[model samples]
Target: MALLEIENLAVEFQTSTGPFRAVDGVSLKVDAGEVLAIVGESGSGKSVSMLAAMGLLPWTAKVTADKMVFDGRNLLGMSASERRKIIGKDMSMIFQEPIASLNPCFTVGFQIEEVLRIHLGLDKAARRKRAIELFEAVGIPNPAERLGHYPHQMSGGQCQRVMIAIAIACNPKLLIADEPTTALDVTIQKQILDLLMRLQTEHRMGLIMITHNMGVVAETADRVIVQYKGRKMEEADVLSLFESPKSDYTRALLAALPENATGDRLPTIGEIFKGAAQ
Candidate 1:
């Protein structure tokens, strides 16, 4: 069985207009020690789909799935308390915005230690030690000193690393990174990506990377799922998807990438067709 299996997952929001389908009948799987990327433009339901899978969607949202399984357990049938128990230990998510996710008043060590204390049931001293080890493992320099500093004191890359440390503190089987590199510079982005890859190799963790940046997907993902307007347009291995895109939407996204897009222009994904275009 797959490590993570999402079958016919659907999500809706009851808005002023009516019930809007943000995610419509999406299904995917992630095996152990593999990186799967969900790539699309903004509002494509890439993030919402995974958020539903993780049971992180807002209370106002309505989510339904035929089967959402992890490690042979059905997520859809589980209680909120049961799901919460599995979240940090068996599955963890590193969100897009580090600053927004972190507490402004607490030090980085305190934040990570909280995870250790709650998940691992460690004492204060043990939690601090584990937090330091986590920081070091994520490549934070002078982890002991850095531990005492708040999130605002660190650079974007460092804050991201801290988030990573916290996420993996309990050695989760699955890690969901939602646009993790969005706030970092090019150099820092590379470092963060490399760190994630290295940690995945060491821990043999399944990864779900959600991003609008195809370049990042190309570098990190083993398989790619292309979404447009809450629908999946294409799914293939990384090489095959890049070499020969089948869908018009996929081809148009590749075409929209600029020649010198590294530091300058971000690629713009093409609009989804209402139907087959002439």
Candidate 2:
């Protein structure tokens, strides 16, 4: 069975103008030890879809799905408490913004320990030990010392590592990384990706990587899903998607990659379509 599955998932937000549908009829599944990449431009609902599945949307957002299952449990049918029991323990997410996601007032150690305490029922001493081990596991230097530091004290890369440490603390079966390397330098981005892949391999966890960067998809994904305008445009194995994309939108995305440039200026999606039309 797939580690996670969602069918006909949709999310609509109640805006001042009207109800705006952000995700429409999106469906996806990821198996254990597989890396699935969801790629799209900004405002394509890539992050919204996953957030809906995680039940993280706000009250103004109306989320509905025909079916949403995780590890054989029906996520759509679970109560708040039941879902809470599963969300952090069985499934975890590394959010887009590391520094913003963390609490400014508390030490990083306290925040991660809170997760362990709530889900695993670990005592104080055990939580601290596990936190140190987790920090070490994610390649943070001076793990014990870093635990007491606030999010602001660490560099962006280190803060991101702390987020990874927290996400994997409970040994989740699935991990959703929503643009985890956003705003980081290229070097830091590569390091974070490598660390994530290493952890995913070690734990055999299903990984869903939400990203707009084609390079990230090539480096990490086993399969790819292309989304545009709140709908799925194409789905294929990573190799096939790159070599022979079926959808024009996917082709346009590939064409926009820097390595694919063939002229003085890279072609925009409109230019690509216009040239094809001519």
Candidate 3:
């Protein structure tokens, strides 16, 4: 069976101006041991869709789906408490900002061990050992000593490694990374992506990478889901999306890539879309 599947999914917020739709009739399927990239511009609802699916959205948000399943289980049928048990254990998320996501007051080690204690029921000593192992696996140097440091004490890359460590503490079957490389240095971004790819393969898990960086999709994704203004524009394998994108929005996104720029000025999204219509 597919690792994750959604049909006729939609999310809307009860905003001051009435209902504001964030995702509309979206459907997708992710198989076990697969890499799926969700690409879109800011406010395109790529992240919101998954957040709603994970039951992380606020109570004010209204989410509906004909079907949403993970590993043969129906997510839509489960209660919030029931879903919570599955989320950080069998399923997990890695956020865009590692430093912000982590507790500033807590030691990095404490935060990571908390996952193990809650999900795996590991004792203090065992959790510590497992936490260190996770840190090391994610390529954090001197993980044994660094575990005692607070979020501010480490660099951006180190904090990200900590986030990954915590997310992978339970060895999740499905991992959703929302703009994981957003604020990192260019080199660090590549390193984080590579680490995620390696972990996904090593653990044989389903990985959902949400980002606007089409280049990252090319590097890591087996399939791509393109979104625009809360609507899905295209779903294709990496090669097909890059080689022959069907949607004008997809083409505009590809045109906006820095690597594809040829002239002194980068082509704006509007310009690309307009040119495509001609």
Return whichever of 1 and 3 wins on TM-score.
Answer: 3
In every candidate, how many clashes are there?
A: 0, 0, 0
Tens digits of per-residue lDDT, candidate 1, 1-278, equal: 79999988889999998999999989999999999999988999999998898899999999998889999999999999999999988999999889889998999899999888888999998898888888889889999999999989998888999999999999999999999999689999998999999989999999999998989999999999999888888999999999998998887677667753555555554333423344
Report the C-alpha lDDT of model 2 over 122-201, residue by residue, as the tens digit.
99999999999999998999999999999999999999999999999999999999999999999999999999999999
Model 3 agreement with the true structure over 1-278: per-residue lDDT tens digits: 88999998899998789899999999999998999999999999998999988999999889999999998999998998899899999889998788999999999999999889889999999999999899989999998999999999999989998988898899999999989988899999989999999999999999999999888899999999999889998999999999999999999998888888989999988799889889
* Sort order, TM-score high to low: 2, 3, 1
Residue pairs in steric clash, candidate 3?
none
lDDT of 2: 0.94
- Candidate 2 TM-score, true structure as reference: 0.97
How big is the positional error of residue 10 in model 3, measured in Å on the Cα after superposition?
0.7
lDDT of 1 at 13: 97
Error of 3 at 57 (Å): 0.4
Q: Of the candidates shown, which would achieve the greatest lDDT relative to the real structure?
A: 2
